[model samples]
Target chain A: MATFDSENAAHLHRELHSHLPSDPALRVKTLESLAIERGLVAPQTVDAWVEAYSEHIGPKRGAQVVARAWLDADFHARLLEDAAEAIKDLGFQGSATGHLKAVANTDRQHNMVVCTLCSCYPFSILGMSPSWYKSAEYRARAVREPRQVLSEFGVALADDVAVRVWDSTAELRYLVVPQRPAGTQGWSEEALAAIVTRNSMIGTQRDLPLEAS
Target chain B: MDAIHDLGGMQGFGPIPIATGDKDFAALADWEKRMWGLARSGVAQGVTIDWFRHGLERMVPSDYLSFAYFNKWCANYLMLMLDHGSITLEDVKRGHLLAKEAEAAPKSIDDVLASNAQANISFEGACDTPPAFAAGDAVRTLRIPPPGAHTRLPRYARGVEGRILAHHGAHAVPERGAEGKKDYQALYTVAFSAADLWGPEADPRDDVTLDLWEAYLVPA
Candidate 1:
């Protein structure tokens, strides 16, 4: 039996379907057109959702939450206690965030989140999941070999710092509250948020940049 | 269903293609954006997330492995619309030429926005019974039979003992939700040490946590 190689599977699919309208773009167009024509969905509805995610919603919401958590001690405590409710304190709540949990990175421990079964991310807060996050390689390895995966993402952790990998198996989503960077004291909330990268909240990156961009 | 989608703890995949700078943050392609919008619209039209995931899980393993993320989503959306009797095979085959005049009133963009905004899939609800296990209770996951259908229990965690880290109140069960049934059960965050799951090869200091329903567990 020949060994299966997932990396080449896409190429193999294209080779097999060389003569067909094998493009996914065509399929999406057909589906959208049919859906709209059948009154199943509005064309503007499609565009609205696209605009909502791409333009309005993204990592900035999560960054604001992280920045607030760093500055407000009460909010930080509430965020750790109940992230879903705490986020609403800042008016950040939506789908995929109802059962949220905020796990903070500390001196002794680090946290990361992955959805091994499909890409279950906190899209309402963190926006659409990153391509690397949704990749098969991440879903396959993040749970068993998290240290190695983090290393691949350029996040090296001390051996003593325990890694807590959250596998989003159910409805609940996670937001990893990375530790505030050093020398970032007395910074404004907006200034603090500017330094918090999307990957940092996802736990693929640690050590936020000190200088606000 | 013991499908390729349950990729946790699997091996032999290459390094993650971590794109540099803002390239990883590039805007979605036009088709990808349309696919995502269509998915949200479907959800607003009553397709549960669990049902959508189940449909994806039912895809042929080879195709599931080969297709891109949005490509798989596009395929699943078509299957769902077909199953829902909203579209026909002939319509899909003929592409844009099959488009018919819509008979229903078109929803405004604001309506769409509001509908989607309120379409939160939070399963959190009150449970009739108290939670069987509390935080710090030792428990073992049930080893469900093969050919499982739309279960949140991953293969790697089955038959393994772990301690409950937190009880997350009652939430709608995905397994039942996939079947168009609404059932609530107490959910807990279960913590398993890396040493227990992967043996000596794993770092002793590390651990993994999974949100599991009460039914999947019993006293260890």
Candidate 2:
């Protein structure tokens, strides 16, 4: 029986598919790096592979629906009601999270999301994850010290606004649809897209004012 | 519209610590550094592919995201002034520049990766998978614990019986707990009536379904 052919090995091979290398050298570096990541290989090859893979993937796009939602109230509602389908219409599948649900953040309340079991997230729409967001520290502390966690992200809730934390259940990967900012009143789609940061939509960061055109 | 982390500021909780040393700044930075170090180290050692890259680590989080995150701190006062037309971008710019410099470092690519969960999976759970269990059938949740799992299945669900409310289809295993390996995994929703999962005290109307792995169940 081949040790690298177990169920886990298959999974490893699947994760391996996500890798991209610009050249032959980077390809070797990436495989070597992953072996060390799983504690399979030695330490000397980690950085080169990381550098290669890191260069392959781009910033998480977040949900394009956040921008769509900002413009379309009905779609926004649908995103809140059924995040997966609403997003699928936009061609965003929860690749990271096989299934998904959306949570919204409002002025009266702020929402923070975490995967208690492990960093369950909706990557189809949100994009590649933040390292800290998936870290054990973020997961363990987010629930126990939520206020502190929000504070770290600089989300200061008022006395009236509530702060809610969602501990990811086993089946669902969740993301945040932040409230549309007031200032983008007449901004065009492209303009609105400029101000929509990935973290803001994820509810980890807040919205910034659009520069006056 | 609530985030999974929106549970703070509830009435039952005590007064939260404010500005507590950058609000666990040391810990957060340390956590990222560790992940960064380990990930980089893993590559340095022998492991090579990371399914994704985090954003901040990839590109500088534009001035916009910087304000989005940092504004939640002590800057609220200044922001309110600017919002009410009390201050100009010029006024804030000077202070902002200093703050940016102070806060800035070699931008990381951590946030460039998936903000949501991205598990590596092979088998595609066809949308139209045939059902093994029906809504009315009484079923039990399988309790096979895979190695390296920090699962949420209560101990009671291990050998207990519940009805199969729905067949959720084949789902890719959650890659994180499985150390980033996910494959064609069968998923089912085991509906434990409030009373069934807990006891008679559980409310009859407030039933919940446990999204379970096929490995976690057998017929009751």
Candidate 3:
């Protein structure tokens, strides 16, 4: 956990005071304090909301979806056919998930998702987006040079395997159903989920083997 | 519309930095978390997610990058509140709203979460206009400047030729929605070949698929 630095705070105050009195960061803090003071906002309520996303709702939810898809053929078909309904079957539903299209990475073709306009993501399932996904560099290069971008993320695909980048410009959210690893045939859904990670589903990284998990 | 935010197939940007393992919201700074909470609360107060996004897009690209992710959200949240008259400059300057300056704000987590949950729902409904293109139809993006305001059309995709991959039905055109208009347009997933969009620098085997409104495309 990193602490806020006063040097940066001083710099911000100096730069933005002309537009507003306090530093932007301090201004937000002050606003929060005022809200609390006026009973307009409860700190506990905010903490609970923050905790729900930070602690409970995350890749593990998506991992469960992936693992269940791996273990049950019917579930896999359901997820690909209508992800929203199928995801709801598992009791997971929320924002930015109204329409989910699950693209599987096969032996010959790979899929990666990027929002070129803005960072539109499957937040309800995958949780909050990573900073790099929202970065200008990723938005620019992912469509222009996906092979290069994936390689930078350490995902070096063979030349023969074609790469398809899904730019989430509209509301459609994509989940890259990464190809399941071998030798996990008889593994339970819970066991398979242990190896699934957030980046793997984003197609920037691969799922670890059972041993790695 | 030739703003910095529409970054696709552009040059000069470096590599994407990868974070190891999966940690949800663990990397966010305290102020970022506060901004997230505040922005979530804004949804309950009638600010649409698209509206908040438009405010973010309104920012200068350089300044947008200067702030962290939630910092950008915080800045935009403040702007929207001011623009909507929910907060005044005096309130902001004083670091607290005066007795009568404060209006409606979300009081509970449920209100915020419920409104935040609405952000996930796609903007789809009955669209009266007929679709101009279908799957497998060749089309070219229109060479039009953004109305100098918020639009979903990225500059990089402008005037580029592609094939419609799928019909995503009709959506409330973001350009109109940003302007507080309720116009709708047919949308489709258009796929452009790498060579077609990026020329020789791109690998020939790759394809970039984007969801575009009908107004942004013309029959090829």
- The prediction achieving the highest DockQ against the true structure is 1
Ranking by DockQ: 1, 3, 2
Q: Taking the tens digit of each residue's C-alpha lDDT, what string does model 2 give over A1-213?
A: 112112333233222233332233333333333333334334323232234234532223453566777888888889777676676565455354445667787777666676543355654555445655654356545544555666777766666665555555455666777777786778676667667665565556655556521
Clash-forming residue pairs, model 3: A95-B120, A96-B120
lDDT of each: 0.80, 0.45, 0.73
lDDT of 2 by residue, B183-220 (tens): 54566656554455456644343334456666666777
Q: lDDT: which is higher, 2 or 3?
A: 3
Which is better, 2 or 3, measured by TM-score?
3
Q: Judging by DockQ, tell me the better candidate of 1 and 2.
A: 1
Model 2 chain A weakest 10-residue run by lDDT: A1-10
The segments of candidate 1 whose C-alpha lies over 4 angstroms from its true place after superposition are: A1-20, B20-26, B43-45, B96-117, B145-148
Q: Fraction of native Cα contacts kept in each candidate? A: 0.55, 0.06, 0.46
CAPRI classification of candidate 1: acceptable
Pairs clashing within candidate 1? none
Model 3 chain A weakest lDDT span, ten residues long: A1-10
Q: Can you write out model 3's per-residue Cα lDDT over B92-207, one digit (the tens) per residue? A: 66877566434444355555456555555668877887887889999999888445356777777778899999897888777766555666678898999988887787788889
For every model shown, what is its TM-score relative to the native structure? 0.91, 0.46, 0.89
Question: Looking at candidate 1, what is the lDDT of residue A170?
Answer: 91
